[model samples]
Target: MGSELEMGKRPPENAGNTTQVQNTPPNTHILGSVSTQTVDLFNPPSNACCFCWCCCCSCSCLTVRSAKDKRILMTVSEKQEDVDTNKMPQLTLEEVHAWGESFERLIKSAQGRVHFRQFLKTEFSEENLMFWLNCEDLKKETNKTMVEQTVKQIYEDYVSVLSPKEVSLDSRVREVINRNMLEPSSCTFDEAQQQIYTLMQRDSYPRYMNSSMYADLIQSFEQLNES
Candidate 1:
């Protein structure tokens, strides 16, 4: 009974004052050292945090869980072109070995094409392979209308000097392409294709043979075969 009476008693500081206490909201309570009202956990104010019921005015309790891992994120360089290199088809040991036999063999295989394309990318001449690939696709099209459209698109993408993906071509080849543009056909890019093919075979293919990407792939497959 004495403890209950002590709890109900007011502080002695306001004993002789004429102040009258007005009734406030029933559940609101002053919290923290600075007398800020505690926020409702269910519907906290915008300035307050939902994870904690304490007012942001004076509360200093920890609010969030500590981070568990610090991962080193790999950044893509600005020079990296957006090329799709996924979904590589399964390759046989013989097929992979054949890529080393000749540049002609590598460009003909689907598996070899992607790997070689990537290798050319490192040399900053992937555009040459892309132009070659586009021309090959253009050759397959029998529709005259589509042949015209694709030839024009390929010219804009690779043959034109204005194109960012333009491949290096001699003036003679460029002049032939300019004349061919008047009556666009599947064979419009044949000369340019031959030039790029020779360029890749002579320059890019040899380096690609000794490239780490090719070496690692062959080593991995060889290791797999042994086991």
Candidate 2:
């Protein structure tokens, strides 16, 4: 009988072909093709096409951005609604009586401020009170840009000699303000505000307290209260 190996195995003539097939891995071509096509998932290409896809086509990212925009729009809309709803409160009889009791008390109230402004308008010295009120409002502003704008506005309206609405301020105070304007601040008009405050306190307050307008307003308040 033939040898067991010789009977079971292929002949030497085909052995070379069989060996060559066995030495090559089953997925060798697949691995070579895959390596050439391999993508780096962690470090994507920084092309405009990819960027556009990320910004426009990525649903999760777009959703987050759109939600942020909606929130901003909603906030602005709510602020506008609040401003629209904020009408001035009406003056009441008790408020009028409290205001009548003292000049200090009168200037503190919004209603009293309005009435006092009207009184000042008649006196032709309304700019003084207006400037003081503007300064007060300016002090309340927290934004630097807005503060700067307000300072400029106040300077033009009340400090400039050429302005018809210029408030009466001494040369020393004007000089100080001019220097302060170089580095404008919320308190740029502080000295001027104090001067005007004193002017109103000394000159306008007593006269306003004793004026026919005051008497008439008091009478009106009483009638309104009685009714």
Residues 65-179, model 2: lDDT tens digits: 3344344333321221121111435455567678767777888876577667656655666667777877887788787766665565566556765466667777788888878
The C-alpha stretches of model 1 lying farther than 4 A from their native spots are: 1-89
TM-score of 2: 0.59
Predicted candidate 1 versus true structure: per-residue lDDT over 67-145, tens digit per residue: 3210100111111234332343446667778999999999998767866765655555677778888788778889775
Provide TM-scores for the models.
0.61, 0.59
lDDT of 2 at 197: 87
Ten contiguous residues with the weakest lDDT in model 2: 39-48
Q: What are the clashing pairs of model 2?
A: none
Flag regions of model 2 displaced more than 4 Å: 1-86
Scored against the true structure, residue 5 in model 1 reaches a CA lDDT of 11
